[model samples]
Target: MIRIELDEAALGATRIAMSPLRDAFCAAHLQLPGRAPSWPYQEWAGHARAVWREDDRLRPLWELFTEGPPGVSDFLMPRPLGTPDVYEELDQLRATDPAFVRAQVAVCYPGMGEEPFLRPYLTDPQAACAALADAYAAWWEEAIAPCWPVMRRLVEDEVLLRARTFATEGVDALFGGLESRARWERPVLELTKYIDAEYAAGERRLVLVPLVFAEGCRLYSTDDPEVLAVSFQARGAAALRERTPGPADGGDRLGLLLGRGRAAVLRELAGPLTTAGLADRLGLAPSTVSEHLSLLAGAGVVTRHRVGRSVYYQLTDTGRSLLALLAGEGVLGTAAA
Candidate 1:
């Protein structure tokens, strides 16, 4: 069990951010020997395995990933500042300070820096950082980038749901509902892990990152006094591998009620998505998606929020109730009464 002590300030500083780099690393970690199967990303793992088998260039990266411990070094998987672009994260990895890299490598690997696979990182941290960045870029492009849109939506939805929980239900409820593997008791959040450890979150930030590939919770903290990052499995990960059922299929009652295209739009809004994202997913023009979104917004079935230059639309409570009723899950007794 690992116990992290959070003061009022630390608790107040807690926030959630999405990390593509962390997801990529977690995906690689999932491929390690003897790890339990992740059904949600099984198909993706098969393709990634084939790439790993055929590509000689990834061998170095693979060695580094598997060499030291059960987890990746915290330096390589820095806590994301916001919704990070993976390419920018690669650049950040490439530009990591040599001294900082060496310090973290020493802590993660301990006395094994002279080994053939680990020597480059300890001897020339800058070159090693660049090489690792190159390896990650190649792996990302080949294995993870194609499926990123769906994965991003899953994480965004998790964040939105948790944020609402924190806002309305207070911190205890928020942490209490995070996952079964974690237990919340006031200022201390206990995590189930293979080892016993303790951390005091003195004035640093605490970040909660949702991983599409995570099977359980993992905690990451560094000696450098940065943020403490906790990653947990996100909801609806199976959708990552499953095919999106076509809205026009005769079995979809929602399609019959709303036009097929509009119903498809509503279903996709289970997670927040931008207009262009919805268009690409549904194979419709952006103009058509915008018109559908406008009507849905006017009807109070969906709501839109502007984040920077992009507008994201998600289902309202009414929209969820409508879906539940159409799917035969909502109880009509209360309404009739």
Candidate 2:
């Protein structure tokens, strides 16, 4: 659970610029999808605002940053936003209310005294705000909205899965050692290939990286699909046993319990095998077999596809990496790394 602190000004600057980028993207394509509210933008902004409002430690820093961009320096905050709901809802909003387009700007950045800069547009303030919407609408129809469906599919199915694995292992185990400055830092880039086979399908246009940060010295966060696993590590606790030399040792503590176990199971099931087939071969309960398969699949150790009712599993090209790592080999080969 690595959490990065963000510069509010940086985020505000980013938020202030988001509409232009979105519009410019749509404009470059030139289709005009019609007037519809963009929920993704709204929610993304909402999250920025939420963090500004909610997170105590980050709030002051963020506020100071938003107060002045130069003061922030080059605050390389992570590009992560909110959950899938943010994107999904944004898409839906765009489809439903074209007028809500300006909401994108208003949601993230604070206006004078709880009033957003977009408030005037909401109440008939005109000019640039309206122009932004019109331009964005054109762009959406031409490029974004059309490609959105498929883009969404990949995010929901694939991105979500890898995020789940990271959520489970990254923080819960990583921090068991001690706290560091990594918390309240910017989110790390989620290597697309690592996220899902069909990763970043549409991200060629927009950068999709994780935001990381720490809370002082004790906690960190890397947002995921469900709950953002913030400060979930067991810092200050007795040190756990070091991971034995194996593929599982690549990551932190959870990797040993999780990575090693999955590696051991997948090692046996390198060849094609059904769930029951695997359970029988491993001599473990069927339920235990299922759990290992889930983790291994997440780690890309194996692939699974439903054949009728029973799902069969096999090693992916990537799974070879896991196996190699476990064998004390380097990435992509069977040589001690």
Candidate 3:
């Protein structure tokens, strides 16, 4: 159990951020054990197999990242943030001192004499950091950037929900909403983990990052014991499996009831998605998807959020109820269930 002692400012400062790098690190778990069954993991597993099948340069890092090891490097995941700025984090990695990087590596992999791959980092930390940054960015571009739109919506929506909870249900409910492993007791926010430790959160910031790939609530802290970082399972995580098609229970009938294209749009929206995303997902023309979206919006079956030039859409309560009924009839997928 890790207990974080929160001050007034720490409590108020708690916020959510999207960490692409953090997600990448979490993806390393694919090489190890304890990976849960999810559509996202299944898709990621395919990608990892294809990417590392050949004698790729990333294969070494992939091997090193396997679980049951003493340690995995933490320099990649800097601090928790209330933003999804990957470039900013890469810049921080570039500016990190060689000694600090080496020190962290040493602490994580204490018996490094046998681990030859990590020797370069110990010998020349600057080059190691540069290499790590490059590797992380390359992996993100290949693995995560393509699906970021869906991933971003999942993280952002959870933050919004938590913010509303904090406002309406007060601080206790806010912590309760984080994860089943976390609970609030007065000044102490306890996280039940394999390890037991505590941090005194004085006049510092406590950043709560909701990561789509995080297996459980984990802690990261700054030099000042008062400042800490907590990354937990984001809400709607199951939706990350957006790439995997849900059960086509009564999809045909639903499509017949609502024109095929419109029904396809609604089915794809088992999770939040954009118009273009819907079109690509359904292999339909963007115009076709847009037209269906317009009709759905007008009919009060979906709600739209226009952010700049892009509009994200989700099922309205009525839409959800409709899907639920269809699901019960075994017409649609598990999305409604």
Candidate 4:
């Protein structure tokens, strides 16, 4: 168990962010031997396995992330900054101090830095950082980028939900509901892990990140006194592989009543999604989705909010209740409800 002691200052400084690089790393970690991805990711894992086998350059990263006899190196876990850009996080990884890298490698690998597979990281940490960054970029492009859109939306929706929980409730409620593996006990947040450790989060920022690929909770902390990050699996991960119900699909009462296009739109709005995203998922024109969204919004079933430049629509309480009632009536699928 790892107990993180958070003072009032630490609690105040706590924030939630998403990290694409961390998602990539967690996905890679799941591909290691003896580790199987969840059922929803079987297809994706097959493709990622092919990429890992074909790319020799990714071997170091693979070993570093997955082949950890002790554990993954903390330095490789980039600090979460709430940015969706993977390149920005990769830049941070590329800029890590050589001495810091060596020190972390020593702690994680323990006297194996000079080994043939790990020599590059210890001998010339700078070059190693650049190489690892390049490797990760390639890995992301080849394996994770194609699926990042849905993944990103899932994580973004999670952050929004968590933010709301933190706002309406308090820190205790927010952390209490984070995950089952983590227990929030007032000033102390206990995380179940492979080793026993403790961290005094005096004034350092506490970053909470959600990953679509993370199977369980992961803690990223060091002696640096900068930030303590905890990453856990995000909700709606199964949606990645779930096929959206079309209007033509039989036994869709919601579709029959709302029209297939509108029903599909409402179903996807379980989490906030943009018109373009809804269109892409439902194979409808953006204008058509906009029409449906406009009607739904006017009917008080869905509400729209603007985040930066994009507008997202989500289901209201009435919408959720309607879905639930329909689900109970055997009209809508459980996923839709």
Write candidate 3's Cα lDDT for 15-120 as tens digits: 6666766766666555455555456456556766455444264544555565226344456567644557666787777677777777776677676635767776
lDDT per model vs. reference: 0.76, 0.35, 0.66, 0.78
Would you list the rank order by TM-score, best first?
Answer: 4, 1, 3, 2
Worst 10 residues of 4 by lDDT: 328-337
RMSD of each: 4.4, 18.5, 5.4, 4.0
TM-score winner: 4
Candidate 1 regions with alpha-carbon error over 4 angstroms:
35-37, 156-169, 201-203, 216-219, 242-299, 324-337
Which residue window of length 10 is worst by lDDT in model 2? 232-241
Please give, for residues 44-94, the per-residue lDDT of candidate 1 as tens digits: 778887776677767668888677776557667765755648888877888
TM-score of each: 0.79, 0.28, 0.71, 0.85
lDDT tens digits by residue: candidate 2, 179-281 = 3322222323121111222211212222222211111111111222222222211111111112234433655443564555565566654345565555444
Clashes per candidate (backbone, < 3 Å): 0, 42, 6, 0
Model 1 TM-score, 2 decimals: 0.79
On lDDT, who's better, 2 or 3? 3
Q: Give me the displacement of residue 25 in model 2, in angstroms.
A: 6.7
Per residue, candidate 4 scores C-alpha lDDT tens digits across 1-337 of: 9888999888888899999998888788766777777776777888889898798878768767655574766667667768999999999988988888888878878867667767888788888889889989999999999989878877887887778667777797789878888999888999888888888768467888899888722645554558778888787666555464454647777777788778878877656678876765666788999999999999998899898888888887777776667544332332221
